[model samples]
Target: MTTTLHVAIDSKTKKAVVFPLVFSGVILLLMMIFGVVMLLGQGKLIELNPNMFYKIMTIHGTGMIGVSALAGSCIIWYFLKQYVPLNTAVFRLNVYLFLVGVAMVLVGIFAYDFAGAWTFLYPLPAQSGGMWGKTGAALYLGGMLVIGTGFLILLLEAARAIIKQYGSLATSLGWPQILGKEKGFGPPPTVVASTMVCIVDIIALITGAALLSMSLINVFVPSFTIDPLLAKNLTYAFGHVFANSIIYMGVIVVYELLPRYTGRPWKSNKIFLIAWNMSTLFTLIVYPHHLLMDFVMPKWMIVMGQVLSYMNGLPVLVVTAFGALMIVYRSGIKWDVASSFLYLSMFGWVIGVVPAIIDATIVINHVMHNTKWVPGHFHIYMGLGACAMILGFMYYLTRLEGGRIDNKLDYLTLWLYILAFLGLTGSFLFSGKSSAPRRWAEHLPEWIPADMVAAFFGTFVTITFLLFLVRFISYSSNIGSKINQSDDIRPSTHG
Candidate 1:
């Protein structure tokens, strides 16, 4: 195999990279804005109808999830080009497909009331009103299918490149080949983990696409027995895995980028690798946990779900925490805005893991299965933890793109965001424990006046998010015009 020199970022690739980054940022901002508005209004603190609340929920979830997937793909694309021999033509095609797919999904969401949750479980879609609703569901599913297709193509291309470069999956999996001992140029851990993730995504895409297609067929074509159980299983199967994979990808960013700003080694310790592998394996099988509330599911399956859910915490606590700890107490610790944000992400993960662990229990699951606690736990885990990772990664990319970081401002804003987010969501969780239900627009019980707490917290969160929006916009606009070396406080030369 022939070796090549490192690729430099040029004007063309830079433009390509900036487009998706900007788009993703805009989408995320819009989601946050709409979310705040919806929460404030629907909680009866500001007064809004059920229809408006549902609409906002649909927009927020669709925008947030779609943007997240796009951001992940963009990150994969941007870094893959630096080392991997990606096919430019295929890459370009994938970008367009993703864009088109996202557009269709958005249009579908806006066309009708899709309060079926982002999961869009079957029978609910069937139970909804009129033809437009059905059509919207079709369009949404179609759009997701198209996006999955694009992801598959990208994965295939990456796999082909890996095979061409390193011979076979076996060779790539081997120690020498992966360690880059043969050529004196080791691939980053992100690249290796990315390859594995792509493979998993491909399988997920196929399974999800097939199930979605079956559902659509059952909708249009008569004489098709739409197995509700099968469809539900497939939907959750895809939803659970897909959602978890975002965190998996975020972990790569955490491991690869965080250490850069912290002046620490990117340690791919054996335990870390094992944890990662086990997490991935466990993710594929953990979908049953969502079905624990259902009676039709087997007793053993329900038990397995709880067991896996608890087991999932091991990798996160041991591997993720230990790795961060390695850098925390090291000599010459330098904390910049990006590093501060990264550290905060770990903190969010730590706080979230407790609620997540509690929710995994059969007893607690019985009480808080579909309550506000669910969103509360996930907001910390995925929103603060995964989303914070995305924010930090974007900050790193901004720096890489030659943006000057305002260390003081960034650090202050990071703390504000985290504190407000926790305060708001923590109140929501408290309400859930007090038997408050989720997705209610109005007529909340007089005894449960948690909306007051939520409203107060929401105000703080809104301001913090708005602050982030301003910082992001200003930084992006002035990215190429300044150089502040003070932000680069860490030792530049890695040992």
Candidate 2:
């Protein structure tokens, strides 16, 4: 006699979360291609209208960050559902709001020639120097506010679910067990990470909302005044925290997914709790590091920023990566695309930190702060680190109902993307060493070759990504058939 065990699957809900993730991923791919084109234009490898070049650059910066956050949040949302009940209606609403926001942003950028960078950095959007009008700036700010509203609702819901189940935010953060050592059972690592990230993100969103609102008001009434320094601090504080939280949100997948591949539980322990708790505190203060170059900034605050930057990097990443290494060591795990990306992302996270730490040093920042190195380091960590994790999760999702991976194509795509990404980033780093500035529309003759090399390799990154994206979509479509098949695998265990 043979018996089969079938686990119930929620295909609709899965698709609900997945639709937004994949939609954002598609936009992300387009932005990468556009970014490569912008590089080519800058390098004089191809002729591009300077206005279009800056427009593409502006949209690319803003879109990539937005998509990365959207994808990461969806991944976190999917996993959080297993432990706590979530409102699918609210999730769907968030998706709709995100799409509307994206549309408005594109209109502002492409249709109206808004060239303010992602930071917008106050005054720059309004002072677009005739490149874009005040209406365009208002549209951009309004779009961000809408996006923030969606995120705020989703985050509040997640907090409500976690707190309802875990009894309190402290318990969700695993503080009761960590502080008192009276652990019976606590929320898992994913929950802890999600809880921590959501708390910080909610606060960041509030600050961002205030900034955008004030900017909108100032655009209409020039009489309204905002202190530049205060605005700068608030801007960096919100932007840095929002960006950093995206990485932590992606790491939640690491805590949840890596263990399954390695056949390890990745239990919520005291060390894990402590590391995340430290993260909650450190993340808020680390934004000051971005303001280190502002001369008017208080000296003590600058010093505090430097200290928090070092402290933040050491705890969460170091602990998570070390545990991941230990879990995989001699585990005889079968290598798959999902697992491979997950493991490699850990390396990217650590390696990217080296340049970041160097830049954070006040001495080095004086020379390197405004150079190509800024984008180089951030792209490595974000493009390779956080983005890699989300891509891995995408692979995981496509395979959830037992879809097969195209091993050869997976290997080819992964290697091609990595090699090209490394070369592109290396060019930026080397150019930064030579004091080449960032955000320039055109490069000098000496700088053109480096930009050309970057553009050349960036083209490969875009191609491989497109290939990966097509394969992911293909596998995702047949999940229902695979799930039904999974229900039929029978086994004989007893006499």
Candidate 3:
């Protein structure tokens, strides 16, 4: 007797998958350019109107986060195609909801001239002008809600696929079932569906519901009072976890790509899997660290936040760094630009995680909570780590699409981009130590010589990034015919 396994692929799903990845790369490149411009102006390295800075910031936040969400959903959608055939109806629903949702967000942000940052904190919205602002906010929320419902449907489909493949969700949940009853019959460890994506999606949906509730309350019952503390907690909870979800997606890329490069069989190492799972578990409860500066939050909660923050770093550091290290050390690693970026991404994570861990300390939080140090820590993590990984993946995918390795010019451009980011973000951190404030149009007396030095670095960094932007545009336009067509364009699987 023979058993057949089926996988689905079609033009619509293919387009849905590829469009978001390419769109995100283009958007991120632009965001970095804008960020460099903004920093240059603020540091007095360049002269620009104050309004431009806010506008760039608004665009940067919205564009980057929008891409992050699209990328996350795209990954889920793509992977689901491998196991279960997504119904045409569901696929159409997914695309429509996502596009509409993104449109609403853009309209809302533009409506308010949304300079208040993506955080969209309360009282600021109330202070903004006109019905357009309110409509924009509603549209943004509506879009997300619709996209979220689509995710719910996707999750159910994934769950069904898992059950069909492995008997039930319970069996799929643990190691034994994944290991299988017979040799060569069991799914690979990574092949078994993990709950991380679903869990994160659920949390996002819950947070979105709360945000919607807050928006409705503000609109209809203008006199309705909200506890500032509660509002702050919910907002940070959503923001923090939502940001981390992108990092988790990066983790997914690492898992999928690393072993291929090493030429080793992808092992279902239980410890590595556990570490990934642990990181997710700890991350959900750690958002309160953002609120550590609040005096009103309970002392126990504060302590718990700090503890969770510290603990969370361990699993990420171990699983990502150590896992990559082990793979690289033992394998005949190749040194293409894509792999080079992947290695550098690990360093970026290390740099950001250390400072973030430090900031989680109560003593350190007292000093750095509202300072430039905050951006310093996150820029390395989000801007460099997450964004770098995305770029690496983009290079790999672009190579696949174009049927060749990216040209030498593209490689040179990528290195230049990396150098500029490090210089710009590193200077931002140094300025923070000397008490330079973030998001300010002008510096006060407290700004010292260190700030001046940082400004100089910022100027050079901006120039480097500007050059990078030009190069990227050139590369995108001329992704020529396949150069080396036979090589596996997907990430290496040496393990």
**Against the hidden reference, what TM-scores do the models get?**
0.87, 0.94, 0.82
Tell me the lDDT of candidate 3.
0.62
**What lDDT does the true structure give each of the candidates?**
0.68, 0.82, 0.62
Q: Which pairs of residues collide in model 2?
A: none
Among these predictions, the greatest lDDT belongs to 2
Sort every candidate by TM-score, greatest first. Answer: 2, 1, 3
User: Of the candidates shown, which would achieve the greatest TM-score relative to the real structure?
Assistant: 2
Q: lDDT per residue, candidate 1, 160-225, as tens digits?
A: 887787776444433453354454323455655566567667777788888878766755764565
Summarize candidate 3's per-residue lDDT along 298-392 as a digit string, tens digits.
98888889998998757756766877888778576666666676777888888888889988998988888778888888888876787766766
lDDT, candidate 1, at 436? 69
Could you give candidate 2's per-residue lDDT for residues 1-495 as a string of tens digits? Answer: 322222133666677766786797799899998989988987998899888888888888888988899888887787788788888888888889999998999998888888888888887777777989987888888898888889889999999999899898898988788877685545788899899988899999999999999988888887887987888888988889888888898987788776666556677788878888998988988898888889899998999898778887568898899999987776656667777788888988987888998999999999998999988998889878998898888877665553654478888898888888888888889888888888888778888889999999999999998987887777766653545243222212222
Clashes by residue pair, model 1: none
Worst window of 10 by summed lDDT in candidate 2: 486-495
